[model samples]
Target: MKTLYKNYINTFKGLSDEIWWLALITFINRAGTMVIPFLSLYLKEDLNFSVSQVGWIMSAFGLGSVVGSWIGGKLTDKIGYYKVMVRSLLATGVLFIALQFLNTFVSLCIGIFIVMMVADAFRPAIFVALNTYSKPENKIRSLTLIRLAINLGFSAGPAIGGMIITGLGYAGLFWVDGITCVLAALVMIKVLNPKKAKVLDELKNDNPVSVYKDHAFLVFFIAMVLFGIVFLQYFSSITIYYKDVHLLSEFEIGLILGMNGFVIFIFEMPLIKWLERTAFTKLWLVFFGAVLTGISFLILNFTSWSGILIIGMLLVTFGEMVAFPFSNAFAIERAKKGNQGEYMALYSISFSVAHIFGHNAGLQLSAGIGFENTWYIITGLAFICAVLLFSLNRRLNNLKKIQL
Candidate 1:
């Protein structure tokens, strides 16, 4: 028993202290991520906004994310990660507080945009910080650790936010979220001291790599965007399909969605560790993961059994577990030391685009065609992406092996 326990403990050993602190910061911030998860509901219930209005407001958030990502990458290359992290967190916290006062549609749209622009900027800074603090070999595990914290916090956030919404209302949600962001910023300031680090000084002197010129990375990025558009259907379309087609209640759909995070929390770290020891390359894992994701959605067309939905969720969760960390690692590997921020920023544009394309396209297609047909479309797309990403990964790997 002791031997087994030691083996488990060894799986998580060797990450730097900075990575641990960053995990804590991520946990704290994400645990307060109640606003976005419930934004549409709050708009509809409290402010009496129409569905279309709520969607437009949500799109504003996605647009803000694109702008934020671009700026965050640019600034991280200039001023360094610590300053960007602190400023973005504090600024976002203030914006969240301001959001409660903006009741009109136009005002709410502007508020959401500004709030997300500040908040989403945190993503690139996080990748830069991780790459800055961690060793090359430890990069995947380090990224996975932070993702674990995020999933854990997300599991807690919506449940806690539900109670907050029930008791203190939407205003209370904003207040709690804002306070947490400010606290996270304070913790970041205390933990990370830029002036003391020589490595950061060196990075500060290096030139930023332009993602636009990297045609190979651009291909990988496009593949990710395609995969994201399908994978993200779990967020936008899966529950609607559950509610409408399967006739599941809201509570059941929430439970199924909750299951995705729970599975990732339990499985992701250990799986990544195991993969690190194996001969299977990251590209192969990603290819198979995409294939599995397609199969998960395709399964729905064959059966109406609710039990099958759980299986589909598990499959998709595992696919996410396999693909996302390596995708980040691959992007990081392609970047030079000082250019991590730019690569991650450009990489993150995939998610931003997925937000607009995935949700809107998935829903519209489901409405226009049928739910089963929608899944088939996503299934086909996932396969196409898997093939494209696999071929691209091979080509990039050969070229970069000599350069790296």
Candidate 2:
């Protein structure tokens, strides 16, 4: 037990103080993320929108994210990540509050689009900041550390969010979410003073290769989009599935979702640390993670018992712990070869694109064919994504050998 405890503690030994502060900021922001998880339910239950309408609004959110990520990437390269991060957070906070007032379909779509555009700009900027703050060797672990903060906050957020929804109603969620975004920005300004922090030099090329022309990366981009599509359902269609199919309450649904975060918080860092020491390549780990995610959804079709929900969530959580940090590290490493901001932005864009397709597709499929069929379709997509990643891994290995 002592040896196990010491090993877990050792996983956190080398990250910089700035990285810790970044993680704290992420925690503050994400802990208040009560809205997104329950947004579909809000539209359906409170606003009386159809599943199709809710899907379109979610798609608009994705469209905004793509635009935001592009603009953020360009701005990060020109003006610096610090300015982008602070402004994005502040603007997003205000937008969240404003978002509460929109009731009609068109208005909510536009409102959410605007809010997400401002909000997602933070994604690539933060990635660039991570590059600045962390040593190359510790990058994946640093990503995992930040993810741990996100999950820790997420674990707390949903339970609290559920209570707020029950006691104060959905409007309360908007107010709290907005306030937290503002608070996180303030914390970032106070602690992560860009001028005072040490900046690592990224790979320098006088004539850097454009990310657009990187064919291998483009394949990986496609795979990421597929992965995002399969994974994002947990936030959208799956919540409704829990509520409608299993007859679970909002708070119960929140607890199940919160469990995903709690599991990651306890185990992900140590898992990543151990995996890093093994001979298995990062891409191989990602492929395995994808397979596990597929299985998580596939198993849902086999059982009607609510206990199955817990088991499914556990499987997906472990898959996420294995997949996301390494995938992020891979993107960061590839970005080193070209324009870092652009590469990372495209990386973020893949998810945005997935958002454009994933949520709507999941909801529509579930509404039309039923949740069982939707799970089967999602399972198939996940496996396809795994196959794509495996191919990408082989290609990368071949390229490395050629370079040698």
Candidate 3:
């Protein structure tokens, strides 16, 4: 046991200093996000909003994400990732704590939406930071580790937040998240302060937005946006579905989500390697991912709590694990040098865009028809996304590689 412990420390020591930094940042960001899954419940049960009203409010962050993605990337290029990240963290911490005080639904929505804008700003900043700081040869490994850290946080967040919500109510969850956000920023500040974290003047002639023109890149990115539309069942719709339809407790809901993170921790590295060894390039895998994800939703429509739901979520996690890093990797690979931040920002658009599409659509469909019907609609969107992704794979295959 002593030998094993020392070896574990030594192995961690061998990792790039940046991995530690990323892990800290991700832990902080994800832990902060713990409150999100519970917020819909809070809106309905605590704040007295109808389900439709909750959807309208929840989608606000999606709008904010679009702006955050563009601006955050630019800021990363201009001011440096560490500075921007630290600032975003500090601001968001305050915003979340403020949420504990808001009683009105509209006020609560605006405050939470603003916090999401700041929180998502970290998306572009940190992606650029990691991609910039790590050596090119280690890019895939570094990204995989980053995802692992985030999943670890995801794994912890839901379980802990669920307990807090169950015991202490929604306000307690918000406070816990608020404290973690500040703590995470502190760990980041103390653990790693790369030179890039230093102050810098803006790059006036920066042309980061040119990412829009890359056809193949656009296709994958667009597929991500469409994929996100359906993924909200995990965070938004599913919580309600589980509570209302299945009559699950907060702890049980956390267990359902925790399963995804646990799988990611155990399997992500092997999955990434398998994806590389075969002709399963990111593009093809993401296309297949969409189909799997869509099928997973269909499974949910038929069965809510059974072996099937577990299997469905497993498939959803499998698709997500495959597609997310692919989106990041491909966007960075296809981008021009010196403008990686911009490309990643464009990539953030998918996640951000998906929030709007997924949540609002969930609201309308769930309200107009029913939750099961909403799954059918989202599953169709997922299938359409897969088709689009397939077309993109072919396009990239046919195109001559630009020698950037």
Candidate 4:
């Protein structure tokens, strides 16, 4: 037992202090992610919006995220990641407060859009920070640490947020979420020095590289978008499905979602270390992730029991553990030294675009057709992503030879 515990500790050893601080920042920021998980419910129940209206509002958030990531990437290169992160965190907190006053559909959409644009800007900036701080070989582990922080905080946030919602309503959710973002901003301001976080001299240059020019990466980006379309359903359509179809309460739903974070928190670090030592290539890991993700949702079709939801979430968490960090490492590897922000920004865009495409499209489909049919569509899409990622194994194998 002692030896096993020591080995687990060693799995996370060797990362820089900057990486640890960044992970801490992620934990602080994600811990208050109360608004988003409950947004669909707020829009549907409190505002009495239809499924399509909720979709439109959610897409607005996605659009903002897209814009924020693009601009954040540009700014991180021109200014620095620390500045972008600080500004984004502070601004997003303010917007969360503003959301409490906006009640109309159009107003809510506009409010959510601005809030998400500011909030989601943090993504690329943090990735750029991870790249700048960690050694090339340690990139995956560094990123996994960030995800670990994220999931750990995610595990806490929703369970707490569910209680807050029960006690004080949506206004309380916004207030708490806002406060947490501001706190994260304060931490960034005090801890992250922009001068120190700046790009290294040899890697620093003014010239910009267009991500679209890389054919291989572009194809990979497309596959990720498809993957995200299926993956992000947990945030958008699945919550509604849990309530409307399964008749679960909000607390129960949060528990189910929290299980995703719990499972990731326990297994991600060790599993990633294991994968690094094995014959499995990065893209193949992603292929298996997609297969697992598909199977998780597919299980729901066969079983409506509450225990099945936990099983499905566990499978989905395992898939996320395998795919996301490695995929992030791939994008960072693809970047020119000076343009890490742009490369990661492009990667973040896949997720943002997926949110826009998937949430809106999935909601419409669910409302028009049915939830079971939606799961079928997601299952098919996941397999398609798996095949696409599999085709890239040769290229990815060649990439492994190049030092990131």
Q: Order the candidates by TM-score, highest first — what do you get?
A: 2, 4, 3, 1
Can you tell me which runs of candidate 3 are displaced by over 4 Å?
1-15, 196-209, 401-404
Query: Looking at candidate 3, what is the lDDT of residue 339?
Result: 72
Runs in model 1 lying further than 4 Å from the true structure:
1-3, 40-54, 101-104, 166-171, 196-209, 245-252, 397-404
The global C-alpha lDDT for each of the candidates, from Candidate 1 onward, is 0.80, 0.92, 0.77, 0.86
Q: How many residue pairs clash in each candidate?
A: 0, 0, 0, 0
For residues 1-404, could you state the per-residue lDDT of candidate 2 as single tens digits?
A: 99989988998998988999999999999999889999999999989999999999999988999999998999988898999999999999999998999999999999998998999999999999998899988899999999999999889999999999999999999999999999999999999998787775455567878999999889889999999999999989999999999999999999999999999988999999899999988888989999989899999999899899999999999999999999999899889778888999999999999889999999999999999999999999999999999998998899899999
lDDT tens readout by residue for model 3, 236-332? 8878877888788888888888888889877776667557668777788878778888998888877555667688889999988887777667766
**Candidate 3 worst ten-residue window by lDDT:** 196-205
Candidate that scores best on TM-score: 2
Across residues 1-404, which tens digit of lDDT does each residue of candidate 1 receive? 79967776777898888888899999899888866666765776689976556656767777787788888888887787888999999998888888999999999878887888888888898898888888777889999999988878777776677677767888998998899899999998887676653232124425655778888788888788888888877765676677667887544555676677777887788889999899877777878788888889999988888899999988888988898888888887777733777888988877777665776677667767878898999999998899888898688678789898
My TM-score estimates for the predictions, one after another, are 0.89, 0.98, 0.90, 0.95
Better of 3 and 4 by lDDT: 4
Candidate 3 steric clashes:
0
Q: What's model 1's lDDT at 249?
A: 52
Candidate 2, residue 239: the lDDT equals: 95
The most accurate candidate by lDDT is 2
